[model samples]
Target: MFFDGTLWRDDAMIREGLGQTTGARMGHMSMCGREGSIAAHQFVLGRKVYIHMNNTNPVLRGCMPDQVGAWVINRHYYQHSIPMTDAAYMSRVGDPALRRT
Candidate 1:
């Protein structure tokens, strides 16, 4: 699973993972988004695995979460967007309606 740690409380995690060596934080939608897309492509093509994104992740920028998730699914890769607020409900209840995408 890929965790978008951009908004994590710890700067060290972001710095080491998403920041440049100069300590510059990368753009969430531009840098990390592309990384996530590439990862999706690789995993879907190479390992034939599914990829799920947390609702908090800003991977697709302006696109609606459900639309992107549907597109990913169409490509034979599973991409589900789970909202942070309803994450507990999903994990415990497994409600299909709670899924955003």
Candidate 2:
């Protein structure tokens, strides 16, 4: 589950009971942003994956080699796994009548 926006993040409330609940083994959080926009404070608990995105945030300019520890598979990389043909992509973007029967 992805929890976005600052208003929704309740660390204590989330960790208070949900962390130890039955079948809840581990929780990981990833702050997907440019660079400076995604602060260290956001990733306070659990395993945090910081995604320094250039298009998403302007902070990516400040993200140095040290700040970015490793290269992880992002959404775009995984998206390639799903086969997309002209038929599928065109149908979604074009008029409904243009879609092949």
Candidate 3:
């Protein structure tokens, strides 16, 4: 699936201090560099969302639009449950400093 000198990422090689690699051989993931590189300031905030997904993954895609909506609601409900569980644990905590936390 590779051709000589074609689709060569010269910038990546230069960034990695690797002169220039060409032809047939593919570069390793270590040399692939980071994804979504952007500067962050107070007014210009940026972050990375780490999610494990695959092209062939059948999650919610098989479901209807109504089913997807229901799934989202359920997901949100479950996410909110974490705070309730934490509050319940804090209520049962005998330590004042921990409770204050």
Candidate 4:
């Protein structure tokens, strides 16, 4: 699920750009212009739980956390899986060049 105003909002847009009807599933995805966008948070959490549950990696690695207090204080689910920094998580997932080796 992509947030409004993000580069690619949904699978239809992605499919149109790539000109393909079928492809790998982009589970629990989001892109926001600013940090802690509420829309982004909602999109990630509101989607089917199974998508996130099945993936081994941190689903919200690149996305920002909700409002400072709300994220931690309210006890939103999957809080533990959020990455400290996008760079660190991306590295752990492996660089594209490294993966090609």
- The full ranking of all candidates by TM-score, starting with the best, is 3, 2, 1, 4
Candidate 3 structure, TM-score to reference: 0.38
lDDT of 2 by residue, 52-74 (tens): 23232333445667544332244
Clash number for every model? 0, 0, 0, 0
lDDT string, candidate 4, 1-101, tens digits: 43322222234335445534322244333332343234436545545222222112233335456633333453344444465464466677657986444
TM-score of each: 0.22, 0.26, 0.38, 0.19
Residues forming the 10-long window of minimal summed lDDT in candidate 1: 22-31
List residue ranges in candidate 4 displaced over 4 A: 1-7, 12-15, 19-24, 32-38, 42-101
Looking at model 3, the pairs that clash are none
The local lDDT score (0 to 100) that residue 73 gets in candidate 2 is 46
Best by lDDT: 3
Best by the TM-score measure: 3
lDDT comparing candidate 3 with the true structure: 0.42
Clashing residue pairs in candidate 4 (N, C-alpha, C atoms within 3 angstroms) = none
Candidate 3: stretches off by over 4 Å: 1-57
Which structure is stronger by lDDT: 2 or 4? 2
> In the order shown, what is each candidate's alpha-carbon RMSD?
11.9, 13.9, 18.5, 13.5
Residue 83: error of model 2 in Å?
Answer: 4.0
